[model samples]
Every structure is written in C-alpha cells, then in structure tokens.
Target: MTYVFNMHDAKTKLSKLVELAESGQRVQIARNGKVVVELNVVAKKSRPLFGEFKPLNIWTSEDFDEPVQEWIDAFAISQSELELQSNKK
Candidate 1:
C-alpha cells in the first residue's frame, strides 16, 4: 500500500516517514496537491569483493587450434548445402 503526504506534513514527519519507507512502505510527497516525490524501500545485497581467482595458462600451443580460413570454408559449404536441400523441397 502507498501513502500520500502533503509537503508540510511530510516535512514535519520526515523521520517517521523514513522509518516507514525503510520498512517496505511506499510514500509520496505532494506540494499543493501535486505529487512532488516518491519514497520506497530498496533492499541491497552485498557480494564478496574477491571470491575466486584462476591462474592463466600462457604455455598453450597454437598448432592444436583449427585455422580460421578452414572454419569459414566449412561454414560456407554447409550453408550452400542447406540452401540446396531447401530448394529441392
């Protein structure tokens, strides 16, 4: 549920309003019957700054990797095959 308070009332009960908002209540402050501001509780969970770190393997061989040109050629061939099969349907 939300509660609306006029500017003067909100100013006078600022502390109480903060307490209510912190307790998951939504509060709207209005000036001259127009809403000026809204207040609500926003819960935040803190995470660990440093949980885990993995070491890098800099001695990996580049010869075991597939060449980019070969992969691109295989992709083009597979796409052409798919297009041929679709056209035959």
Candidate 2:
C-alpha cells in the first residue's frame, strides 16, 4: 500500500514509514499538499557466478587436513579446564 504523509507527520513517524518503505511499500512525503519525496525499497544487486569454467589439475597440499600441534595442545588444555570446571559444579 502507498502511504502519503505530510512533512510534519513524516518527521514524527519517520521510523514507521521507513519500515513500511523497506517492506516494499511506496511512501510519499509531501509539502503544501504536493508530493515532494518518495521512499521505496531498493532492489538488491545480483552477484555474478565466478569460475564457472573447468580448471585443470588443482591439487591441495598433503597436510591441509592436519591440525597444528599448538592448536591440538591448546584444545587438550581447554578440555581439561572445562572438565575441572564441570566437576566443581
């Protein structure tokens, strides 16, 4: 639905008008009984699909799936701390 609002009412009810505009409603703001500005929902820009063509022989490194030793040690310590905290409750 299109909502028409005068300048005074538009200033007071701006938030609600903005919500209505954002939900695809056309909101009109007028001065001296004439429409001055229009608010409407902006359409989102579409993204183009990248790399649709077939790539030749892209291979990942052997250690790609392996966890770092530092992170493993930290994870173990975090688990131990969590267990201690759970036992105290």
Candidate 3:
C-alpha cells in the first residue's frame, strides 16, 4: 500500500511510517498536497547461509519459469489495493 502524509504528519509519524515502508509499502510526504518525498522499501540482496541452489536447467517448456496465473492475479490484486490507497490520498 501507499501511504500519504503532509510534512508535519510525516515527521510526527516517522517511526510508524518507516515501519510501514519496511513492510514494502510506499510513503509519500506532501506539502500542500503536492508530493515532496517518498519512502519505499529498498530491495535487499539475498544470500543463503550455505550457498545458492543451482538450477538444473531441465525444464522443457518455454513457460516453465513463468509465474502461475494465480500468483499473477494475487499480484494484480495487491497493485490494485495500492492504487486504491493512492487515490484516497
């Protein structure tokens, strides 16, 4: 979800906003309803403790690595929710 706040509100709720941003939400701090700054979760590089799993490269179909439709739908739903939240602001 995207969160919107004015400068004062953003400052006052900095901690809470950070917590939300850490959870993959976008936050926009506005001045007079004009967006000034945005906070978002930064993508982190992931490392396995032991090592990375090697791909077998045995898949036969071109769509083998494609995301399932259900997952795509879920993502779409999530995006829609974020858009809705943005509209509210």
Give the runs in model 2 whose Cα sits over 4 Å from its true position. Answer: 46-89
Of 1 and 2, which scores higher on TM-score? 1
| Model 3 weakest 10-residue run by lDDT | 50-59
TM-score between candidate 1 and the true structure: 0.50
lDDT of 1 by residue, 4-74 (tens): 99999998999999998998889999999999899967678776578455667779677767678988999
The RMSD of every model to the true structure, in order and in angstroms, is: 11.5, 10.1, 23.9
TM-score, cand. 2? 0.48
Better of 2 and 3 by TM-score: 2
Instruction: Write down the TM-score of every candidate.
Output: 0.50, 0.48, 0.46
The prediction achieving the highest TM-score against the true structure is 1
Q: Which ten residues in a row have the lowest lDDT in candidate 2?
A: 46-55
lDDT of 2: 0.93
List the global CA lDDT of all models.
0.88, 0.93, 0.90
- Write model 3 residue lDDT over 1-89, tens digit each, in one string: 78899999988999999998898788889999999899977788888766578867775988889999999999999999999999999
Highest lDDT against the true fold, candidate? 2
Overall local distance difference test of candidate 1: 0.88
Q: Give model 3's TM-score versus the native structure.
A: 0.46
Tell me how many clashing residue pairs each candidate has.
Answer: 0, 0, 0
